[model samples]
Target: MAVSPELEGLRRIVPSRFVSFSFPNPFLGGAPNPYGDSYAGECIRVAVLDSPLPAPSVPSTVAMLVPAGRHRDWIFSTRAGHLHLLLSSTHVSRFIILGPELSAPSPRVVSCVSRPEPDPAHARLLPLLLALCPAAAFLGNARHAVPDVPLLTFHDDLLRLAPVKVVAGPVVGEMVVEDVAIDCAPGPVELRRRLRFKRMPCLVQTQVRLCPSSAAAAAASSSLLEALDGSGGLLQPEVGGSLVEPYLQAMVAGLAVIAPSVDESIQSGVRPTCLCAGVGGGSLPMSIRVGLQFNVLGVEADSVVLDVARNHFGLVEDEFLRVHVGDAIQTIEEFSRQGEADMNFSAVMVDLDSSDAMCGVSAPPLEMTHANILLSAHTILHHHGVLILNVMPPPADVSFYQGLVDVLRQVFSELYEIDVGNGENYVLIATVSPIETRVTDNSGQFLTELRKLAGDFLEHIRKI
Candidate 1:
C-alpha cells in the first residue's frame, strides 16, 4: 500500500538510524538473531521502509526496523477482522499481527516513531499528524487501571439528573395566622411543596419577611427558598433524610452533645422528649423525631402555620410527635408551673423570629428571651438537658449580642455559640448543668462531631 501523507511527512523528519529485525523461518525450527544480540530486550522506536527488501520466507513473518529510544509505542494489530492501531507504553513478550494475505517480496509496513522534542516551527504540524492517526493514548504508569465507564444519560424520568418540569402553581390556600399572612403553594413536585409567610411591618417600616418552607419527599431531591426580603435565604430540603439548613443542623448538633443522657433515658423505659418553640413548617421538630428518634412537642402561636405544615410540608402527628397551637412563651410558662414531675423535657429548641426590627435582632422576639421566660424555659428541662436558640442579630452589633448572651447566662451555667457561617444566624446552646468538656469550644472539633452524628443518624433512618 502507498504511504499516507501523515506517515510520509513523519518519515521525512524522523532519524534515519534503525535496527532491522525479522522472524526466523518456522520450517527450519532454528532461532536466528535477526538484529544482533546487543539490541535484545531494549526499549526502541520503529520505522517501516516502503521499499522492497529481502523478506523472510516464513508464511506470517513480520519484518521491521527499530531505533533506540525511551518513548511511547504506536502498535498496529488486527482485531475482530479489522486493523486497529493503539498507542501504549506497556511491555509485552510478543505481538501477533493477523491479516488475510501475505507475500514474501512485498509486505505491509507499520511505522512507530519516537515523539520528537518541541520545535517552534514544527509544533503546529505535529498535532495535525497525531490527529490523523487512529489510535488512543493511555497512561501506562497509572497507579490503577481505569475501567470502562459507561456513558451517563438522563433518559429515565425518575433519575436525579433528569430535567424536572418546575411549573409554579397558584396559591391554593391563604390564611392570616397571628397577624402573619400565610400562603401555601404546591410547587413542581410533592417534594417541593412551599409555604410563604409575610409578617406585619416593623416599627421602622422595614418589612419583616419569613423564609419559605419546602419539603422534599424524595431523599435526593432539593430546593432553595430565597428570602423575599433578600437579606438571606434557606436551603429547604430534607437531604438523605437529614436537615439541610445550616442553622437547623447547628441546633441538632446541640442535641448531639447530650446524646448519652438521651440514650440513658431511653434505656430506662422513658422516651427522650424535646420542645420546639417555633414550628414554622415543623421541619426541625420532625427531624428530631424521625432522625434522632426523640419524641417532640412543638408549639406555634398560629394554628394556620401548623395547617400549612400538615397540608404542604408533610407534618404528620402521631404518638411521638405532636404540636400545640398557642403562644410559645405561655406554653413554656405553663410547663414551668406544672413542675418537672409533670412536663420536663430533655431538650428545648427556640427558632422564633422577632417582628420588632427596632430590637436590632431577627429572632426570638425580646419577650422570648426575657429573664423570666428564660428562667421558665430553664426550669422545664431535665438536669442535664440543653436549650438551643437560633438567633439572628443585626450585622456587627456586638453589644446587642453580648447583652443577649448575658441574659442567657443568668438562667444557664453553660453557654456555647455556633456560628452558622451564613452571616445571618447563630445557634446558641445552653445547659443548666455545666459540661466538663465542651466540644463547641473548638469549631473544627464541633463540626467533626456533628458530621459523625449526622452520618450515623442518616444510616439509622435509612434502615427503617
Candidate 2:
C-alpha cells in the first residue's frame, strides 16, 4: 500500500482528535450507483494509479483528488448510506481519508498535474492554519467555506493519555504543493490537527442500579408515552412484569394479519402455522405472547437476559418454543439461508429493537444494519409472512425511525401500525401481501377477515 506519487497529497486522513465508529449487525443494504450518465455519480477513477483498492469504494490506502465542479453529488457516500466514498469519475482522482461524517483537512487544489514524490527533507510541514489552505478549494465551486462539521470532542482525560510530544504541539505529515492559494480572514478559525499518539479505547464507568427503569417515567416523547404518575416503572417486580400496551397491540395486530383464523382453514384441511420471533430477549413479554399463540424462536444477544427469560419468563427450546443466544442478524441470516422447506411459521413478531433510548448509545440503526436484517428475514419469510417491529422514536432525531418505516414499506406490500399503550414504542406491522382490512361487527368490534371464528380485533389475535 505504498502512497502513490499521483496521489501524494490527497490522503483522507482525519486530524488526530476524531474517532472511528463501528456499526452493529448485518443491517447494511447495498446502494448501487452508476458511474456514467454525465458524471452524476462519484466513483473516483484509479486506472492511472497502481493502487490496491478500486474506485468508488475507497480503501484505507487510497485517496482521491476531486474537482470543485461536481462537489455536491460527490462529497458524501453514494452507496445506500454505507458511508463508503464513491466518486462519479475519479479520472478527476482516487481517494481516502476521514469519511464523510467527520471533517478532514482539505488537500491543495492546483491546475498543475505533477506525479513526482517530493523528498521529506524538502517537504515543509506547514503550521496548523496553513494545512487548511486547500480544504475549501476542492469542496466545490458555488461559494467559499468548509465542507463538514467537527462533532467529536477531545476529552481532557483522553488527551492526558497521549504522548507528551504529540500533546505539546502539532504533528506533521508530508505535503507537496504544485500550485495553490489559501485566503483567510480575521474571524473565529480552526487549524488542521494531527494526533501525536495512538488512540486508546476509553472506558465508560457506570454504577448499576438494582432498578432497570427509573421509579418515575421518563418524558422522552408525548404525554401518552410518559409513565403513569402513580404507576411504578413497567419492569418493577411489584407489578409482576406488567404488559406493555404497544407491544401487545402490535403483536395482536400483526398476528391478525399474518396468521389469521386457521380454524376455518383447518376444517378444510389447510392449517397454517405461525412462528414468532423478537430480537432482544428483553423481559420476554413479546416472546411469551408469541409462544402462547404459536411456536416461537426468540433470539437474544445478552445471555443474562436470556437466562432470566428462561427461568422467570418461560423462554426455552421446546416443541413450541426455541431461543437462540447470538446476534439476531446472524441467527436470522442462518434461518433465511438454511432450512427453507420444512420451516413453517406464519407470523414473526420482531421486537428486537436496538436504539439509543434503550441502549444508551446510538449506531446506524437506520442504514445497512436494519436493511440487511430485513433482507435476511425476507429470505425465509413466507410469501405472505408478516413482520412486526418495535420502533421507539429517538429523543432527538426521529429521522431514523421514519427511514425505517420507509424501508419496511418497501419490503412488505402492506403496512399497518398500532400505537403501543406506551407512547415510547410504536409497533409497526407489515405484510408481504395486502392485509384484508377488518370490518366492524354488530358488537362494535373490529371484525377480522375471518370473522366466523373470532368476533373482534382483540379476540381475533387472542384466538390466533
Question: Residue 122 lDDT in model 1?
Answer: 29
Assess candidate 2 and give its lDDT.
Answer: 0.35
What lDDT tens digits, residue by residue, belong to model 1 across residues 3-67? 24444442221211122223322112222322223223322222222111221221111222212
TM-score to true structure, per model: 0.48, 0.40
> In model 1, how large is the Cα lDDT of residue 179?
13
lDDT of each: 0.47, 0.35
Q: Evaluated with TM-score, which candidate comes out highest?
A: 1
- Candidate 1 regions exceeding 4 Å error are 1-191, 200-240, 357-361, 395-398, 437-464
lDDT per residue for candidate 2 within 240-312, as digits (tens), equals 1223232443455555554334334434565344444443223333334332334456665556545433433
